[model samples]
Target chain A: MTTDAAVELAGVTKRFGDVVALDRVDLRVPSGVIFGFLGPNGAGKTTTIRLLTGLARPTSGEVRVLGREVTSAGFEVSSRVGYLPDVPAFYEWMTGEEYLAFVASLFGLESSVAKKRAGVLLEAAGLAGVRTRIGGYSRGMKQRLGIAQALMNAPALLVLDEPTSALDPIGRKEVLDMIEALAGKATVFFSTHILSDAERVCDEVAILDRGRVVANASVDEIRSRAGRKVALEVAGDVERVERAVAAAAWCRGVTRVGARIEAAVSDPGSAQRDVPAIVAAAGAGLVRFETVEPTLEDVFVELVERAS
Target chain B: MRGFRPFFLKELREIARTWRIWVLPSIVVVFALTGPVLAKVMPEILRSMSSEQLGGAVISLPEPTWKDAYAQWVKNLTQIVTFALVIMLGGTVASEVRSGTAIMVLTKPVSRPAFVLAKAAANAVLVTATTLLGAAATWAVTLAVFGEAPLRPIVQPTAAWLAWALFLVAVMTLASVLVQSPSGAAGVGIGVYAAISIASLSRWAVEHTPAGLIGAPGALLAGDRPPLSWPLAATALIAAAALAGAAVLFARKEL
Candidate 1:
């Protein structure tokens, strides 16, 4: 484990009977940053989170959290790690405040400290003054309380699995904001298939696909490495323009939508020079021709497609 | 064990919030109150029915005693209380696991043994309280109706029943850990109870197995001092084994 890494997994292969959930998966989450585990559904993201949280053992390798081997350290290391499952379930009979207090006590916090911390976390989770039973909470409210409970110990590493998967846009924003607020205070390793959520808050991301990590880099690096997409809006037959652009060796893929043509280009410099001439040769009046920055979604799709 | 106190308190709070605290004790108390009243009235009701059937010919009946009252209480416990215990605790661990609540708490600093032990302790405490309250109520009612049921017979039998209840809880706990569904756990618990009851008919099991513990109370009420030490010790050992087994299995279980 690196000195700065909050979680590290080396050659971790978790298999259930005949199916492999995670195969030789290696990942490192640095301290004090939001590391997004980005993958589509069934891409081993939750499996990775479970391994890191010590809820399940690896079939064949080592997992370390907060510099302690999870398999060997047991609850000692668990004390330093806070985890929220994909669907966080609580005692529905308990009021939100009571549940949080109960969690605080599990961490062996003093009574006064537990009370103060519960109050602060409740406010931070946007659950302040909500004394209703958890059974009465909305999906979003339950998620927020889940986060609050996970933070009761002020843990070194916070693991959240799809925290925003089922929330509304407003609720997603609320959870994302809470995750963002943890920057520099605790290392937040959250898993999500939502590219926009990761793009908005993640400093680093690991793209997992088919039980393996396809890419692990900073968000900016993935965006840059995915290269630029060129958008050409023309006032002629879009099919003619698309063919002209697609024939070019530098253009990776092209999609035509009515009067506009969007082409992913590997060599942006050459494509920039050639696209205009191709549009002219095709007898199309070009309305707009510009290079657009690649989104995390594009990188994710490209990596997953290529890996598959 | 770490986090036992908080977890145990949480279990207690859950019982109270879910109304198990009141409902279970109320069931026990109702049975207790009805025992002595039924014992005092049954003979008179039988005599009246016999006289009516015999065309007003007088019929005499043996007077009811405190033993009858205690016996009624024991019967109610073995039937109603046992059934209630199985139903109430069948899902104790299975529901938590199925709902993913176990994952939430198990990821914290709490050890698996502590979690299992705390739940067992909370349930034991509740059952003990209910048993004592029911016994006290029965004692007062029996004294009023039967003119002084000796404390020793009532208290001893009640203690034996309490031990058996704890043993059943332990069985349910182990079954809950072993099975995925609450119904399955209940089935296993009831199966174990039935097996014990059936096995008690064996000649060797009469004096050797923990099955004898459940029958000790009735034997004591019948003025037969059944040897209780071996069966009680065996029940304690088996209950401890079940709880310990649950903890060990849960520790290795993948949440």
Candidate 2:
């Protein structure tokens, strides 16, 4: 792996019985970026996490993390990689402090070191002074503890699986904020179906659909892929205007549904020229014309729908 | 250390807050106290009932003995305590999956093998403690009621019980690894037990093969006359190890 690549998957394939959980897929996560793996459930998000963390091996592929092949993966990367499972499981008997200490022992840390580090992590994750048993912790508190455990070793790459799915609105915000705060300290590759969480924290994202990554790029690169769309609600003669707009070589795909005309244009500058001429020639009264930029949710939904 | 300590402690906490911990112990304790009392009084009670119906007819009944008291305790364990033990440990991994708790631990640096091993070790400790406590209580009560017959060396029986306890723990661990829900694990655990029991019953395997570990515990408890051999002891130990290994392998297996 290159110094810039915190995680790299080359032609990874995972099969579950007869079903293909992940197809021959490749993903790259550069250093110091919060990368989001956005897909609906069973879209290979968890499978990818399993493969990367060595929880499960890929049927055929290579996974490299922190400049090492994941062949001896388990605890090697565990120290450098913190993971928050989609719904983290914990020992309800432990207080937040005790739970962190248990995770620290996995790293072979001294008792004093583990306790000190766990104390810092608990406070950082905003779980300080919570003396209740984990059984009594709210879903949000559990998620916070999950984050704290994942980050306990001061890992280089933190992989979280749908960490915010169970949290309330405010809780979700806090978790996302915690992730964002760790941007420079660790590389986070978290999977989420919640687009807003990804939008809030992720600088990079991959859209997985049907066991393959349909779109993998920086947030801006994907936003740029679908280009821009101009929607027009003309008062009269929409078909004539759509036909006129369709005849323009610059307009890529044009569709007319009732009075609303939608066209995918490569350049908004060309639309500035064609829209007015068509409306004037067809004697159509332009009710509203608006340019809509694609959102991560829109791109994700469109990509998944098109791939399937 | 990894997921095991955290997960094990978590289970202990769950047992404390819920009614299950109290319920399981209370039931065991009740059986322990009642076994000897029931044995001594049952024959006379039945005789009195018969005399009342038959108008004071002379009736002879077999006197209850120390053997009967121990037999009653074994029967309770085989029929009821065993079921409860299976239920308690069956959900070790299942409840985590259902609650989305497994996701949190497995995604960490903790290997799936360690997770399964931790569970096996923890549940084994809990079950063994509970079983022995009940056994000890019953033994004490038997001494109090029967005035202590010549104490026989119990080395072999103690070993067998320990083996059985470990076997139960391994089986329950395997069950948890195979299913995503507690109910699913319990069903599969029963199915596994049934399969092993059926295998042990086949005359072809019992005479020529080392498969009797599955059946020997019950056979011995039921008063079957068989010499205790090293092969039988080894079979239990090996089976326990194999089941634990399988649990580790399956827990690490991808979902």
Candidate 3:
């Protein structure tokens, strides 16, 4: 908290014609962490990235990255930042190594050092042995090369838009590992519709819905905000069991299946203490009783659905 | 112009590695070789055709000269090479934007002005090199075919045409920025060219505007000196203005 923030947006509102893409969205990401910007398609995640990268201007608000206002930075601030769009494109005639070298030249990297750095990055990206032109590459290979191209500068802040959106399971895992390896070296802000990928690597996440930010906090804190859910299974009189808990002070809502009942509880401690006894009094043997924690996906769906 | 050198080099490499290298240079080479040969054979062709159509009627026609050969070369370069040049350079910025390649470069420390000016400079080199190559070929062949041809006469007209071609490069650069598609940008370029040709029909327009440069090449090669200062200065000013306008507007576009 003492260090300066990596990115900050205050009351950012972007509109394309009459459609509002992002509406008064405000967020702050601290430096030296992996932050996730999670949303479904059409949730304005890319719009936010465009503003931060100076590819776009907001209808009304301030967008700052690494402590400099975006529009003012123009070219100078980009030296310390790297970005990968959702669909990264390249010159079809260029070989993988040639493209990286071109990117390095833009950053003013020396020839000798640039080649070595490019080799190391290509190796890390799993494209070291490939010598074909970029036009001949598959989608996955292109994505790997894209990651390599973005790292040519060793930027202080890396912004990625859906880095794993097109990868297979194994490829996604390797990319996630690469992102996990970059936790302290740079501030990695990545957006994804896949909640599990964000859940796996992010220290904090913000869920956006319908052009609005519904939740922004650490993973555990957001999970806690979904409250606690309890499921109980009994031998007999499941309807009586549901009736007993539905009227309790701690229970928020209850749903009964054929022989089991699930309920949301405001106080997990009170529910754990009282639910078993209440079920026994309703003449049903308590076969199972447990409190379940919501996964990040469950939390995301709950938050987004509630906002909608 | 923070990243001008590297960006410009990349553009040159792109031109060499793609189909762009083949189109303009090949067009000029073909025209340069054939223009003189066609000029030499035209009188005989007309005599042969008229003998059959006019039933052996006598005819008097002047002998073709190196001037005819040189004029044919200039006409082809101006009418045909200019269109090819337009189609070739029209997508300089638009294709990059559509293909998302601009995003890759613009995200670096490269300035917008540098991105646009790099394309302009690199394509200008291509246009200049090919035009000069064609002119040299025509000069050598015209001398060989006609037994006598002056180098100064050939050089003057080619220089004027080169000025107009380079100005078209700047026009296409701005067109690519204003229009998002390659063909659409080329359409804008051709429309401007047609407009200028039509406006040049006026005597005053030919004497004062860039339309003057369009016909200046033929007149200069025939050993007639026009008031060229106005057209040359106009070409330079307009080209510079188009480039500066492209840079300023591209900087504000929401990619």
Task: Give the best candidate by DockQ.
Answer: 1
* Among all candidates shown, the one with the greatest lDDT: 3
Locate the minimum summed-lDDT window of 10 residues in model 3 chain A: A1-10
Q: Please provide, for model 2 over A244-275, each residue's C-alpha lDDT reduced to its tens digit, 9 standing for 90 to 100.
A: 88888778888778888888888888897678
Superposed model 2: Cα runs more than 4 Å off? A1-3, A40-42, A92-98, A109-126, A131-139, A165-168, A230-249, A253-263, A273-294, A297-308, B1-20, B62-67, B92-100, B146-160, B171-226
* DockQ of each candidate relative to the true complex: 0.88, 0.39, 0.78
Tell me the alpha-carbon RMSD of every candidate. Answer: 1.8, 4.5, 2.5
Between prediction 1 and prediction 3, the one with superior TM-score is: 1
- Give per-residue CA lDDT, model 1, range B118-210, as digits (tens): 888888989999999999999999999988878998888888889899998898889999998999999988889899999888756757778
- RMSD from true fold, candidate 3: 2.5
lDDT per residue for candidate 3 within B1-255, as digits (tens), equals 999999999989988999988999999998998889889999888888788888898566789999889999889978999899898877999999999999989989999999999999999999999999998999889988999888888899999999999999999999999999999999999999999999899888888788999989888987888778988898899999999999999988989
- Candidate 3 structure quality by residue, lDDT tens digits, A1-308: 22398999889999999999999999889988899999999999999999998889999998889988888876656999989999999999999999999999999999998999999998988889789999999888888888788888998889999999989998899889889989899999999999999999999999999789999899889888886889999998888889899999999898887777889899999999998899889988999998988889989998998888
Which regions of candidate 3 fall more than 4 Å away from where they truly are? A1-3, A232-250, A254-262, A273-289, B52-61
Give the CAPRI rating of model 3. Answer: medium
Q: Write one digit per residue (lDDT tens) for candidate 2, span B55-154.
A: 8886788888777777677667655776677777778767766776665566565666666776677667666677677777877888899886223322
The CAPRI class of candidate 2 is acceptable
- The count of backbone overlaps in candidate 2 is 6
Give the worst 10-residue stretch by lDDT in candidate 2 chain A: A70-79
